[model samples]
Target: MTGRRRWSTDEILDTAAELLRTSDAESFSVRKLAAALGTDSSSLYRHFRNKTELLRAVADRILLAAMDGYRPQGDWKQRIAALALRLREAFGEQIELAVVWGRYGSGGTGSRLVMEELLQALRASGLPDDEVPVRYHRIVILLASLITSEAGINTVAPKEYEQGMEQFRVAVLGADPERFPALAHFARDIRPLGADRPAAFEDILAAHLAQIEAQLP
Candidate 1:
């Protein structure tokens, strides 16, 4: 009992976060994390029971960090949109962890905060009790969509990302001038990633907000 543990959970989580930032999902491993900490996987297991538990804790830590300055404001719709955007930014910020929890469906306490606020926002709409659950689920789906998507792959896998970009350029940017008139006409605007993706997210969020507004008396 007198001996100090090799590494604390906070330290392990921080180190794991740093690894995930640079390493893609396929490359990141418990062995790599232990190596980074000048220890071994068993040492990490000493603190966490298993890999799934460790990943959930890491995702929880990142989610909590993403809410560092969050304070609810504005009306119901604005408040809901804000929560979505904040967590979207959070998920995008540490998507590797997001992929972990998304696969396992372990959002834990950090996601619960958003869940609570979203329910409040739906209630603030004054809709009948029957309507709230469905809308709440839709918003959660919108938020979770970023996890399995290609939104944040640029940081984790630059080479593969660039390759995908090149393929898009060939397909859309370099399409035939005559056979596909619409694509040729909007060639410049059809590029992937960049502002287009976030704009699309905004469009979806705005549409969802409008849906909520339409239901209000």
Candidate 2:
């Protein structure tokens, strides 16, 4: 390479995110990212103290990018739903990145803003002050768990796993109705794991909202 461009911190984070999206976490490293940027790994250390810092920075950048145009409007539940949908859409693009965000936490300005916004939205739900923290943690945990699970499923090997699941469903459907009536009856609705991720996510969110509503004093 002739003249290596002097990358800014933002540039480094952006490039790092790109690298992460293209590669698995196990193979991701400072050297690989530096090479991708046409610079030495040492250059990144100036912007990030270590790999953990770098990963967190990249994750935050991705989150900010995802929520760039998001605005919390409508009632509390609607606002929460909108924010959740935005997050899901963002994580859905590079589900693997969610693990990184979860590992170190979204310790960036974007995350702070999101946290504040979420708190505000949750408060609008009419929950007592004492219950806010617990409900907040629950919603955040649900989001992370669902995102990670969906990401893991998306990374499943080849396409045979899905085919195998379908085969199993067919087999179950063929079972004797007397012995396995429930399974036989639901066979047609049986979907492969993670197949209904969007619906499942929504259901979880709805459940959380319902719980909050029920507990409101």
Candidate with top lDDT is 2
RMSD of each: 3.1, 2.7
lDDT assessment of candidate 2: 0.82
Question: For model 1, how does the per-residue alpha-carbon lDDT over 151-189 read when each residue is reduced to its tens digit?
Answer: 455353677867888888899988898999999999988
Q: Which ten contiguous residues of candidate 2 have the minimum total lDDT?
A: 153-162
Off by over 4 Å in 2: 1-4, 163-167, 170-185
Give the per-residue lDDT of model 2 (tens digit) for 1-217: 6776889998887777787777776688999889888899887888888888888887887678777988788999898888888877887787668878766777898788778878999898888888888888988888888877787877766687768776777687687889989988887887667577889989989987988888778
Clashing pairs in 2: none
Compute each candidate's TM-score over C-alphas. 0.80, 0.86
Reference-based lDDT, residue 174, model 2: 81
Error of 2 at 211 (Å): 0.9
